[model samples]
Target chain A: MAGLSDLRAGFDPATVKEDFTLLRNPHHDHPLVYLDSAASSQRPDSVLAAMDDYYCRSHANVHRGVYRLAEEATSLYEGARQKIGDFIGAPDPGREIIFTKNVTEALNLVAQSWGRANLRPGDAIVLTEIEHHANLVPWLMLASEIGFEIRYLRLGEDGELDLSRLEETVEGAKLVGVTMCSNVLGTLVPVSQIAQAAHAAGAVVVADGAQYVPHLPTDVSSLGADLMAFTGHKMLGPTGIGVLWGKAEILDAMPPFLGGGEMIKDVRLDGFIPNDLPWKFEAGTPPIAEAIGLGAAVDYLSGLGMAAIREHEITLLSYAMKKLEADHGDALVIHGPSRPERRGGVLSMQLDGVHAHDLSQVLDSRGVCVRAGHHCAKPLMRCLGLAATARASFYIYNDESDIDALSDALGEARSFFA
Target chain B: MPGLEDLYREIILDHYRNPRNAKELESPPALRAEGYNPLCGDEVVITLLVDEGRIQDIGIGGQGCSISRSSASLMTVSVKGKTLEEASAAIRSFKAMMSIHESSLAPAASQTETPTAAELAKMGELAALQGVVKFPVRIKCAVLAWNTLSECMAKATDAQP
Candidate 1:
């Protein structure tokens, strides 16, 4: 609710950008204007140092070894769980936060473990047209096996979720899977309202927060979601680390997602007893170093403050939208909700006479890194009637100058193609 | 913008803006196959009419980037009246030109060179696409039409007997 000027007096983009080494890209003569944070954020020096400190000082497998090094490693890993839990306001850090390779795997864990145990044939699973394949495909795979009907919440002409038919969509659904924010459209869905609706229909709600948690302040309790999936890489942390936070009772009741060393209590000839709530879902060795890095990333974000980050991004988005509209006008068509408050800083633009690929190529020549494609949301692209879009997403490190560079490059691309 | 100029050559842009044979073929003798680049959502459908081992007519339909659309347009002209074997050979040569090892294979064939009359007649304007090898990601775009052509040819052969 606080404005950027009101939140943090010392919050500055130039200073904040210094923390990230990749922003100081030395390969190109032109400074790298990275606009692809929605794909994966660039890590900060503190996160890198944290991972380095772990591998250098304390390197051992967790939960199995009793040695001092192993004990230290376990503490660091568990400590990250507490930090991330606090960051997102999870109910119980130890019991609810399960680590996986990425959000895709985390969603798969929910579909395979929780969905399989809870759903039945003829049960319906509600989803949205804007969900990334990560959140859509797993449920589809489960639907094929369980014979559940998949109902879709359509995207409105305004690019936001059309909840006009919310009651009918979630009427007989066993679960409602949705993205908190669309990665392509940048439309922030009303998750709390949707969760309330789903609960009224006697269906649990699972949210894909891969694009939301990084940019905004997240509280699982506030959102009223039973389960949430997010990745570390999109939040200034390393890859190969994702989190699935769920209600402890729900996680405890679900079957294990995979059979492995750490996710078990005891193994016999006939069967194996699963471990506790969260550990039962985390199979094999976890991403120890990446977790440490994520913890450091959390620390960095907490230092800057999430509210400040959100405020900064909103300001940047307003500035960007105004600049783009005033400068390019009819030559560029920006997708999603026109109001900055209604969307995140992700701008999916269609330049006149320039294809997304060609636009991206031209932008790259100018050292502007914008993502161009379906962005793993092909169904959403189909809904928009576009084969692809050239997306430029903003983050904590980005500023007005980067957007200016992108605009200039895009102008060049359009004229070049013409 | 040296690299950019090479990738988006004037000839390539010409083919893209004014795509030749950009229509659907009547079905009786036309064999068609669809090709898609999942990464970019670029889709192309190639329709070929092969009669007695010769490609009598070729048509390309669908939408994509300049690289893909232009490639499809250029492909129709290059293989329209050629024998099926000659079309196949042209595809092979185009693929070879777009290969990552193209520099090692043909070190002297940079974009700066003006093609001899004989060489230009042999390879046609597709040689302009040779610059695509420098950009690895766009190579798939350059090859989508050729791949669809191969698929159409295979389907035509299968339809026989």
Candidate 2:
């Protein structure tokens, strides 16, 4: 089998790992084998330096000051917006991209702004069972207030979304919310297909790209989503910055989400006019340094190439699955699509006779950082009959050696329990 | 940097492997309470029959990590057949023992101060759980059942009036 280390010299993780400072520093006895990138990726030196440089040179409140430093700060922040929108092939980068705290806030922005303005009592919205609480909770919160009905797209036994009744389920629904990738199972959903059906049924589609944008090549138009939400922290950028990309016409029709200084054009004693397309959604002084850091992150990923990153992850995933199955045999159960090509680089593992938390504790002792929990998707966990799962997710910095370490740790844990 | 040996003592593992009172009591005759560690999805359900002023029997249910499972098992054995006041005292002492390090950091203050020799003696087998404080995240797992039992006691007390 072609492992990550054996990949062509042009794209090498060993060289890529050097760019991240955290990987070089070992806080534990063992070297850090970070396999939790899906939670939050480690920032490269370029991204870190970009944020630091911005603070040192130009630290000013954006869009308000007429000073030179303020102009520079505003320029950097808006430049980031342009690049990020272009990253996902947004039609009009200036008008379509809205910055929020994180993906949760981004999703809430869509549901609160669009759903509140358009939806009424007895109107139906469709959400899949595998959606993160970020996607599900916002719609549920709106439905409660508006007295609308929320329908679910059930998950299949094979850990894929059951779209057999896609036409019937989304028939007259006003909106459809779905995740582009399962955070727990790593199963990639065909959003384009879902969007087609949702559009045919006169429903607008909102895709949660939190787990997908970091690991795959994304084109907003090709995705066919009216609006998409994704975070910077999970894609090699800092926390506190997220992107909400929407079609120009759709965003133009929506009302402002949060009311504050930047979101308004002119204020009166009684009422006020909302700002333009993107700023109307961005209420407060945004995360200036973090946005610059995210722009640097996009630059870093572009240099390395997203396609190469995906290929590297596929090599790692294929090797990991084979090695785990060969070494552990019936002792371990891997969730999601058996084929690596069909999924991202996330592996949620369950060891026989061992709880996910115990397994993660054991892995931690060996410096293998894996997430053990419902992964913010309790509905999906309940569907799988699992309280929790030990998830090991790969990114550009991971390789086959990390997989070996994980396998070796599993052996020790199994034997220790025995 | 305590090793796994500190967290996974043999006695704790034994209780985890063979949990005591891993069944639910009848609801009409028993008071029930549930606790959940939302971070890790570790849940512990407590059902106990409180008659007169004493706990007649106790039951443990739900699923969790080894630390939680064993802690629940140890809690049931520690409180069973004890008077209501005595069980409540055990709860206080156990919680005090859990937060011993936090209290020691302060200038010898409040009810949750470091346990005395007598209180330590009261902890008995439950003292094995002090290792949990080392891994702060797992502390919730160790205390889930204790907190649930506290709620159950509150329910039992409310029924008296």
Candidate 3:
């Protein structure tokens, strides 16, 4: 199996760390240790180079103009679709991929376009209490607009999705969409189980693979998802480029999201006709260079087997949780799921005394970075009885030693009040 | 590091271990205010015993960081017998000091926003936390209590003669 170091010429974590010249602060000489991969992944040199190469060589309008530049641009752009399709294990690249701005936009595209068209006044959109605002808001907007009832699957004591209540929540629902892995709770939902439930309810299942695809071997068929949306930035690619993959039959059934240049086959003065499959949803100038970078990121991630990445992250999470418990046992309250393998890689915690904002500040003072906020899941926050949590997430680059540093900082914070 | 200077400084730990005034006050005459940091959900309630124009007493109730809780504690202890106008002026001085006017710390500009009761309590010793301005991320922690004080004042004053 290919590993991280084998992917590149010299991908040494020690020697080839991120050269973030743009991310420097004046106070500290020590290298900033960033542990907030759930928020955004640091782009590797390869992703940057791939984008720079695309801009340098073939930078032209795709699907427009008959010249060689346009043809090349169109091929490269279409080629990214194939790459993304292959990366996510979608068989039909042509029908399976629609490039979006981000996961949020892709989810919104499904909600506004598909939900608006398919769901009527009485139809229901079943979601979980732990959904990020990206996945929840669009459906909410649709539900309010079209009068579709919204039901949420509650969480269990284990911080996992209450699979027992799945039928009750999703029964008679028109659509059931949920996250594969949580950004805050770090709990990994059973996508296959959810899909089975939704399918039994005669509802289409859309998976928020934003947190899943980056860490797991995501085969859309095996996962049984009708639609899946994810972002490039969180998976170590350039920002502003994301993917929305759906089953061909499902894609055919949904109405177009946006209309313009490339999403049409024929245009008349009266009304234009929709293009075939994926192109029907991808309107106007797509993020060409960012797509190329995402394709490169996919190559990089794939080269390092997703299983290995998952294993590494689980080990880090377990070690971090253990260390935190051992040291700050009396004071710290970790949110989401504690079981490492059950979750993805997010570790959101709140110290007993220190506010998350203050905790994040103290941690940042020591060059240990973490995200502290409501994390765009107000409903989840309410579920957990917390307004915000200080989150420290991990990825392939993060190791057990990083967890030690985090634990040390946290211990220091606890002792600061001792 | 109590013996050898740990990563967590002594002052910070002392503040966190024993939070000050973590309780509620009786209603009426107390300018009830709540300071909340929406970012972290650190909340503090402030109650002031304002007799005529003078501050008879002040106390706080809430949860938060060592800095926020400690600052609230210090504020309650510091602002006894100060007049409401004096307290309001002090709040103006503290806010200006913390926000932008650190170097000179004199009157840089007059008050633009109408401060509530909680906002008024944020003045005085609270101004000492001006160092938090340097860390933009932690600025909210420093102001969480102050904001609560302003809110308390606002709610109290709004219902007053």
Which candidate comes out best when scored by lDDT? Answer: 2
TM-score of chain B of 1: 0.84
List where candidate 3 sits over 4 angstroms from the true fold.
A1-27, A266-270, A326-331, A336-338, B1-21, B25-36, B44-62, B71-84, B100-124, B148-161
Q: What DockQ score does model 3 reach against the true complex?
A: 0.35
**DockQ of all candidate complexes:** 0.67, 0.80, 0.35
- Candidate 3, A46-147: lDDT as tens digits: 888888888899899988879998888888888988998998889899788989999999999999888878999988889988898999989888777888
lDDT per residue for candidate 2 within A1-418, as digits (tens), equals: 3443546524778778899999988958899999999999999999999999999999899999999999999999999999998888898999999999999999999998899999999999999999999999998888889999999999986678899999999999999999999999999998999999999999999999999999888899789899999999999999999999999899999999999999999999999999998999988889999999999999998888888888787888999999999999999999998889889889999999889988999889999999999999998999898999999999988888899999999998998777
iRMSD, per candidate, in listed order: 1.8, 0.7, 5.9
**Model 3 chain A: lowest-lDDT 10 consecutive positions:** A6-15
**Pairs in steric clash, model 2:** none
Q: Which candidate ranks first by DockQ, i.e. highest? A: 2
lDDT of each: 0.89, 0.90, 0.77
How well does candidate 2 match the true structure in TM-score terms?
Answer: 0.97
Q: Model 1, range B71-150, lDDT digits (tens) per residue?
A: 99999999999988898888877776675333455555553344455764677688888678778899999999998898
Sort by TM-score, best first: 2, 1, 3
Using all chains and alpha carbons, the TM-scores for the candidates as numbered come to 0.95, 0.97, 0.85
Native contacts conserved, per model: 0.89, 0.75, 0.61
